[model samples]
Target: MNPLAKLDQLDLEPAAKTEVAALIQSLIEQAERDAKIIQAKDAVINAKDVKIAALTHELAYYKRIRFSTKSEALAPLQRDVFEETWNTDISAIEAEVEQLQDDQPCATVARPKRLRAGRQPLPPHLPRIEHRHEPEFCTCGQCGKDLVKIGEDISEQLDVEPAKFFVHRHIRPQYACRACETITAAPIPPAVIDGGMAAVGLLTWMLIGKFLDHLPLYRLEQIAARDGVSLSRSTLADWVGRLGVALQPLAERLAWHLRQRSSLHADETPVPQLDPGNGKTKKAYLWAYRSNDLQPGPKIIIFDYQAGRSGRHAQQFLQDWQGHLVVDDYGGYKALFAATRAHPETQYILESCIELACWAHARRKFFDLFQTSQSPVAQEALNRIAELYTNEAEGRDMTADARQRLRIEKSLPVLTNLHDWLQQTRLTAAPNSATAKAIDYSLKRWAALMRYAETGDLPIDNNPVENSIRPIALGKKNWLFAGSERAGQRAAVIQTLLGTAKLNGLDPAAWLKDTLEKLPAWPNNRIDELLPFAAPD
Candidate 1:
């Protein structure tokens, strides 16, 4: 009854019948192969559609986050941290979408073009070194006779010098004794790097360029090469090492001062370290600790580089210091809050570390949920939290005692109501739902969250330290990763000094240059005088 089977019944000679059946079978096989090919093509098309849909969704999400007014949910400094990443991701997604569209057989919709601002005048404050371009011939092209010049068209372009390398020749004349024929020259002045060719100014430039500006040593070398200066990466690396050694005491002193404060902010970010054995990179941590901005003292930021995010690393850095520590909900810092725990170094029992939970972090949980689902519960929670922040914002410039009074008058009731609301909300929410998890986070840390309301001397959140760490996070993307543990630690040292300088409203380059010049001849006992901040008011 099959179509192919009918070939066998056809009336013909024996050889003709055999040839007809064989041809029909071959045709059936070819048809089956064609059907299989069509199915595979459909599957491929479906997969591509799914991929494009996902990419489109991601692109839209990033665009909304980047362009929407709600992007200001985080503090300016916090938002600044991820601005570059969002821009890069958006560009990458757009490029991938374009590529995929080109591959498709069907017509594709192009992305909407972003409106761009017209070119603006360059800053008038910049010292312009002008280069005038004049025509080779004063006469018009069509005319043989010379022509007088009229008003010239003028335009300005912003230009920069990467590094203007210069020489500082320190000439020391030799003096000879007439009788003994003894010759002597002035002794070389002390330098951060002894007997080094680099001046303090040059050292400062390299240091700031590599650490603060996030330029790698090789990049610095390349920059110098463009100026016809021969600076090998090896030499740059050696200078960084020596500079770290010279600046270590200052960073350590900063840590000492930071611990002396009654309260502080702490956080950590991951850094990559090269592993030669596996020929890949491994994770490291840069733990950042900062003095509370509200307290009456000089601002300080200390960076501690560790191979892992063990609680022990924090314990080691904190030592016997005890104070209110404003931090995120990282489990690593939980050990620090235990009533009794062995010291990281001495193994001696110590008092518990008072915890002050970060409101910004708690707010982020609800913020993320609201963004994703537009849940009324998240909105209500955000409103309550925003009320608390509003009170804090009003009292930001107030004295410690005045701020505390303001919080007691304003923030305490809101916090109490918010806690009650969260408890009630949790009862109705599914135990495994994201809403429940978010509620639990706040409820579990309620006491720590309320601590800041009781004392204005303590910070409301850990944004200060996180803000300080943001530069380091941004820097890693540029330099990629540390070549070794020593390199990471050295970076931490320089970052501490430079970051503190910036926090205290000092120009980092100028401060670093001055510090380098004084460090060599500076006495150990008087090192505090060389801190980024002048003596605390």
Candidate 2:
């Protein structure tokens, strides 16, 4: 400033003054260029710092996954510790960024906690056995006066009586006509398993025990021995086999009814099948198909057993059905959907069955990546998916039209944004990383995943069928494997009826007992009356 003032005071010639002004302008431009260089360097440094933080988080995530409890739930104290650490780290990063940008730190807001519910009371329907206790001394010690009767203290302790076995004597009185010499006796009521000592009650108990309770035949035989009733495993097996055959018609009816629906959920689980020839167990599939929740009918689940996990199994079972099929990203269903599209003229494709992909499957990919890598990209994808699920929850009980409208209004924009972000982010992601794979999987099934929003009748996932198949998964651990192909098929039949009965809120044992008693003389045309939902309350 002093040099410039001195120049002004110098009263120099015009050319000298112009030269000095040019020099000063050049210096100012150089300073501005230097400042720009520093800003660019800082930007690169900040980017690197973000990458380092993400990688550090990812490393810690992997370590926790490897060493921590498998349960996703955290104890209150553990959660507090985690939140404290996360907040401290986040605050530090925020402070650094604020310092770099010369900005104030934002205030932190804690999330509101949800209120816990009180203990629920026991059901009122159970029979009560009251016990009365009389005090020896009715007089109060301090007052020396008789205590007045006010109220009785009530407490309940549940008790159980061990299973009681009984026998039913079917008395058949025969009378001979004296003159005609003709003999006549009252006919015995028909049993589910004809000519077998096992009554309908015993058959129902065995079926319920094996299929619903997952008790193996040998275990049930042992249980029977404890009750002083010696039932051989072979006898139990015979009963089960006959019951399976008797219920075959009912299971077929259920399957037929399920296929008539406009939409269905399908899934499969592996069952080990004993191969006598190889002296080893072979893997077989138990396919479960469930009726749509929104469909106007009683919910039904049918399990089909197949020797292999082939698309043909599903195709054959679902033959002549044309509607939406919700399933996971199993390749076996691709052929079925393709056939539906190819043969629009065929009866199977008259309505052109649409393949609705499960959002759960898509979310699983990113979830797995997040669990393994804790990548910000994966987390962002998970957050977006969670929003879609939130929207689904809001529309869960809405009418079909209202639900579709809600999805179109709220979900469509999210999907569009997610699609764009995935496209842009994929370019920068490493080709071989878990995050990249998740992105690719979602983008590949983008059309199918997004299709759920188009119709309210379609569910977001195939969880109904998946849940239906869960019993088999649990049973497999105890039973190990099916004895043969026929045994596997029998299991499928029993499971189908039991599963459907449970879905309809009917007690499996009671339903089976009633159905077994009635199905023998029940009219063929009125078979639907025997369905679990149609049973008397």
Candidate 3:
């Protein structure tokens, strides 16, 4: 039936055996050709990878020159300056130490004592009692004036709503049919997820604190304990995990929205995820994508986390995305945009990260300048860069088309001059010089890195995404890593919702709760209504 199978089933006599062997050899050659074709396709992928790596290498900032643009009056701070800043009342400490034999206080500072721990519970089910008689007294000693109660203004303060486990009361009241018609007294509520314990509000609160606010679950547990509530960190982790599963559809839609933009900014930061089977740990990647489309549409930001920085991972994550993607020349992205079906798409454009190759980084080549702060060369670079940024800042609010045109008309000449001067400066500059290396990097990646200026849709700097990534970077110091792969994705989903809410200028808790209740019954065809940019009623 099959060509290869036919080779095994060949019928021939003794004389014809040699001819049959020749036929088999031809079939083998055909198989070899197919293998070569596969390898050729792989080669194309490799070529793209090489190009991306080359670009990424050019953009990566490795060496930095610590330039001091400050004047000599503000020299590098002494260690004591830090000591004085960190410790309270330095002069008081010195004077007190000098006067004291062992330990003595001059005076005690009166401050409200802060409660550290322990909470007293209220008595159960106490009913309110009110006296009919007026209790207020007049300011006068005698009956000079009598204060009369005209109207009672009842004010209520909710001091405590006690930490309690929540239960969704679903009342399914049945009705009997009398005249060929049935009636029911209760209506069912459409929950975000069926049989899910986590309410959307509580779930979003956990995420906002964990990701957006960089509060670790353990710390959250501590905070809860202080509030007379005790929730386990493990339980919190599971809550986030389940939240991720629920949000996957939205995350995919977000990625799709990001790709629809004219361009996107992407970056990756490392996250440590635990490995259960091996009793060891492994690396995880938090890949972030941000895009603001000004074509009469709302801005969208999406964050994703993958287990590894593999080329295949990028390909799969961005499977639905197509557009000009602005990213540092990461090889992972190169492989993705190469062999994947999204490859060769006319809408998909790759713009290089040129802002990273700025004069600020190049100026860092001179460490001595930082030590002197008064160094003229370092000051010259700083002054030049300051002017460029100031000029560009003026165009930030303009339309993408206008921004592009302005960059070409106004900013192009400054970049051209800076590029030429840096090349000339690097030729004779010291090889080991920080200034020289920075200049060299800027020169090499000048074209690709500066590509942002070519279009108004792209930012002059990759700051929007970088700013978003900073919270996660800071968070790693406290919470550290995900306990597992699914945990990392959970973090990503929470971060996405929080970040999107911030973009929409809505409270994260409110949005998450609304979304959860709305998402399940949400018409799959009308998911856009849930997007941050959707029109309000």
Candidate 4:
């Protein structure tokens, strides 16, 4: 039945038959080559399409950076029908209040309005210098009568004293024994930096200025020069370096304390490090670990600096640390979780660390697509994720058991529906498109994302640690880069203490001043007493 076989069976001379067969074979070969060419062309077209999509996405991203607000929150008008509904509700409330006042037998009392919308009164703890004012005459000129003082009105305006520099002279008075001719003198107190001129107070001030205030050593040096203190940048750097070595023990203790918690949030941010050999800057990472926001204990945040963003960095920092680690879907953490699963018997770096994926990260992907593409699918995903956030908001202050029940009652259904929708949506979306990638990211981490609902101790997202990273991100813009790897590590040490102080609602300057003063003689075992939260109230 083959067309070639029919040609073979045709009656003709032997040479004519052979010629016909050769022509037919040549045509078939040409047809096969043409088909291959068409297939190759199709592949090229597909590759070009992918390239175009990527370029378009990149262009959109740059446009957003130029024109859009960085916040993911919707504008007021887009969020709700603010003009129509909010105004109507306010007017109705005012009318109702007026009607109620009209029906009252007594005169209506007007509510006191705020003088202006700005700063509240300064804290009472701040020292005040009172200035008294009195009239020139005690008696009124018009009445010619004696005036009695009733009450004094006190108005306060904040005042600042510029930086003052002074030298502390450690004068040692010697006494000679009358009979034995032996001399004795009082011993000087120990200093934070031995043989160094800087006092604990000065060191503390410099640290708070640089780390908390995000001022670099060079800038601090300039500020000091203006204040008549000619401290060089190298001198300031030396102090910071020594301080880092001295306070390293405290940072380690904080990390130990964090690991002991049942659950904690983990995150990392990029830091630029100076590569002396290359004469260029290289990227490093600051790994952040903090106790759960809902947990009842002294809140602690520790930053561990690493030269690379490798899984080994986190593993080493969290050595044998067993707890729930709430983090984003960074592949570096996967190895740690895998170790725990593969060898439950052996104590690995993160033997019992539970991986809880962040919903915020997953939602961020969809949000980016929605912002760029204005896709309905992305918007739907956002709406669903928002519901989970609402549930978390309601249960934020609740106990673990109560929050777990609340999540089950409210968030679980939404999560289930979201998962199903993402699975179906993935099939319809183009394989290489952004929408598909977003869907794939969420679906792949579905279990980890839902793990939060299992316990109230875990947060729905790793926002707390992410929030802690913001300071470093902002500081990077000012300080630019660390002088070396060691310098970066030093920054991490100070950042840990300052970050922990902020979390505990303590002033960084005050905490550092007190800690630095006592840390010199503070016993190793009682170091916890010197922590920011444990410091004198």
Candidate 5:
């Protein structure tokens, strides 16, 4: 009790003020300690990043050095193939060396053919005509006389026509009994028995004759008469109109199904759409979408037509589609990529043509420069590019993933080094300089350009689609454009069936004939099955 009273008495007004100051000083010290802790945390993050970079560098170094050669450049700096033969007269020394070493005899070298740089030869020969009739007596007064042949004249021309086919319709009749109203006479099982028009076989021929073969209706009518089928251009057009209506549902479904696939290739070409308002015409666009069953999934291809080339056209086709969609570097697809919003974010179709970037295209650019003094870079790139192709040609049939893995393991380093070398050279070259220009091109689209090494399954080029569109391009040359939007739509449907039939290894005319005659009676639930592509042989 005495100690507690003494302690309470010591806490007077002056003592209380001293004690409060000490408490405030301790709180300030704790704040300083927390600041040091935060600084240490940042330092740790910085140290970790440094280590990561160092390890990455070390790994790359080991991988390159582990290879057989010190430098994994695409190829050696020197060119291998001889530009010209300079055979030394060392045959005696070669035989002695071969005898001593038990080696094979030295082979003789022959010089390569030299191109004669000159104007190409003129036409083979002049026309050989004697012109037998000479001049007779001339008229003096009002008397009849003969005249001499005038001086010979020569005119030369080369003519070309667009690729063109014919439609044949065989119309068969049917009779029904009104007494029973049940029994009816019909055409042959596969003949054109519906709607009392062209026979089944004729319509089929017409479908292929015009669509697959790219023949105009007028030409088809002419051919049909020769073939003993009396089909008129107008009647063919009318039947085509009906055919379009009948197949619209299938065509629409085909387009939808093609878009649903995960990975697809796309291309577009200018289409001339006829003008109804004025007699004038405007250039529209027909877009193509193709899918293959070989690598990624089941194959499907479709062509889409539109009034204009707006980005909206692309958006409309790809609106709900998601996943890999291969396309050229067109700005129209930007909105499409943004909208798909796929989870796990696989590469966009923009990356699909990666496998087609090969030595062929790259090498073609430098062909003229190969033997010139400005050839080291071009030749090096070519040789290294050749290595990648050599690998591809050897392993092209392998799966895309396997092929990609091999590239990453083997060819990837060479590509990387080649790309790096090109990049460095590009900076020192002139803007208009030829070598500089070549290097710049290789550097710019280099990555997108060389995607071919990724897999063998992809096309070497966009040639298939190009080949398919060639018919339409030819048609454009002759017919110029569709007579109406309805005609354009009809072209799309007939082309779809004919093209699909061709793709599926069937005779288009036969398939078309069978499909048209039987499609009306085909079950609604099995509509998709009746499609040319999906139909059984």
Candidate 6:
């Protein structure tokens, strides 16, 4: 029954009852409003609690990183790839914590600044070019008398020559052989592209700027213009197209060498290709295959740009080549493994390819879970994975046999424990939970994950090729998309050569310039001599 209805039963006058009912209604409405406000406050508090937990976990991670041994930290390559994001994450977390605590007054504690290496002297080997600066007047301003020079204080500033342009004037004097009336001086020197205005050096600069430096041709044009040189975009495009054709042989040779390795790393990154018909872009793939670092040979990386990410692209690239291939759990590579071989009745006997799963991929799932939810299960998984990496680091520089022995002795035990833990954890974890998914991922690929421990030549992860793809991923921001499929393939050719050059520790620009100079006249029979891996004469 309504409380207001109870007034009817009370012994009171009509007006008195009406007044009492109004007061009761007002109080009830006020109580309802108060309940809603409290509910909202509770919701806000819940959100803050979740946010605080994530931030606290992040802070603890940073603290561990600060005090942890070098072997326990991320590898150098991974550090280089993630350093910027880590810094940004730290700042974002601090801001969020400050916002959450703004309403509450608390004692503030100052954090110690992280110790960092101070700026050291500039490289001593770089040639120093001197520039003298003199005052407008040699006389003192106050005293109208000439000032005597005592000494000069000099400080060095790091400087760069941004696309400095110069001209090479080739003057062929006409011979005064009136009898023959033949103006025969030295025949024009052999050129990479005869009659082209760009010298091999200039061509090299443009190639390096475009591919290695990740600058687009238009940007290269703007850079050249800054140096009072006018290089049209079309001309650059023309040069690039011709260079791709010229360097295709070298890229092919590098790919051949890459296949010779018994172990390899394969990975891919998506690239945007312009779709002229739709007035938009379509997805393309740049498949990167890198030779094993443990193998005794030059480091080779080949990029094969294709229209799509179908498994055929990889199959075609690795046709007749067989080795241990390290890759992520992408479905496209499923056909490459013998157990999952899509074509079992092929006429020719295909070489066997052993599939190796990347531990980093498996660990990344738990890493992300820990980051977002601070799950203790995920944290434990990460700790176990870290132990495996620590062992790998200890034997990083050892010979293949030694590394294999070290892994069997030190890493196999950890792997055994991790596998057992994963299996046990998965049984108890909820089927739909993130922890279960992470555990299942490792369990499904347990054999491949542990295979690296069985061989020293196999990498623990597909980081080598992934690291090579990083530059291309970064380049996509500037270049945007390839104009056509052909353009993308051409880009792959150039990137393969330049990337291979970088892997060999050669200055890409210098190697490219020398190669361009020799390529036009170099014999095809001896073409391998001009590859990026070859030592300069």
On residues 1-537, what C-alpha lDDT tens digit does candidate 3 reach at each position?
Answer: 455456557676756877777787898899999999989866755654454444333323211111222332232233334444533343343334333312323212222223245544444454445445545555445766766557885433235553354555666878878988877667556665566566666666777778777888888898778877678988887776666787787777877776666566677878888888888778889888877443445656777889888767656766655555655545666654454342366855543212232233333443355455455555655555566676578886787788788888877777777767667777877786756655565566676546666666655545567667777876887887688776787778778867877776777776777887788788889987786564565
lDDT (C-alpha) at residue 106 in model 3 = 22
Give Cα-based local distance difference scores for all models. Answer: 0.87, 0.81, 0.63, 0.82, 0.61, 0.85
Alpha-carbon RMSD, candidate 5: 36.3
Best of the candidates, lDDT: 1
Worst 10 residues of 5 by lDDT: 78-87
Ranking by lDDT: 1, 6, 4, 2, 3, 5
> TM-scores, in order shown?
0.73, 0.76, 0.62, 0.76, 0.57, 0.74
Model 6 steric clash pairs: none
Off by over 4 Å in 5: 1-194, 227-229, 276-278, 293-298, 338-383, 432-461, 534-537
Report the lDDT tens digits of candidate 2 across residue range 3-104: 566677777798999899779778878988999998987676666556545544664564454446432335334554566776566556444444433331
Mind giving the per-residue lDDT tens digits that candidate 5 earns over 1-537? 433345455645766755755665667678778889978865654554454444445544543433333222222221111111111222333333334233212222222233356765445554443445433556534556554555866544444543233455456666777888865555445432345566565666667767766678888888767756677788888877877788777777777777666556667888887797988888888887777443653355577777777778877776666655555546676566555333456644342112223344455566545646557777777777777667766666777777777777777787888888888877876788778866765666675565654554554345455556666776676677877766776787777666666666667776676677677777777877766674443
What is model 1's C-alpha RMSD? Answer: 12.7
Instruction: Please identify which of the two predictions, 2 or 6, would achieve the higher lDDT against the true structure.
Output: 6
Q: Any runs in candidate 3 off by more than 4 Å, and if so which? A: 1-187, 196-198, 218-235, 293-296, 320-324, 329-376, 534-537
Better of 2 and 5 by TM-score: 2
**Every candidate's CA RMSD:** 12.7, 22.5, 33.9, 27.9, 36.3, 15.1
State residue 289's C-alpha deviation in candidate 1, in Å: 0.7
Error (Å) of candidate 2 at residue 465 is: 1.2
Q: Which residue pairs in model 2 clash with each other?
A: none
Candidate 6 segments whose C-alpha is farther than 4 A from its true place: 1-118, 130-155, 176-183, 339-351, 534-537
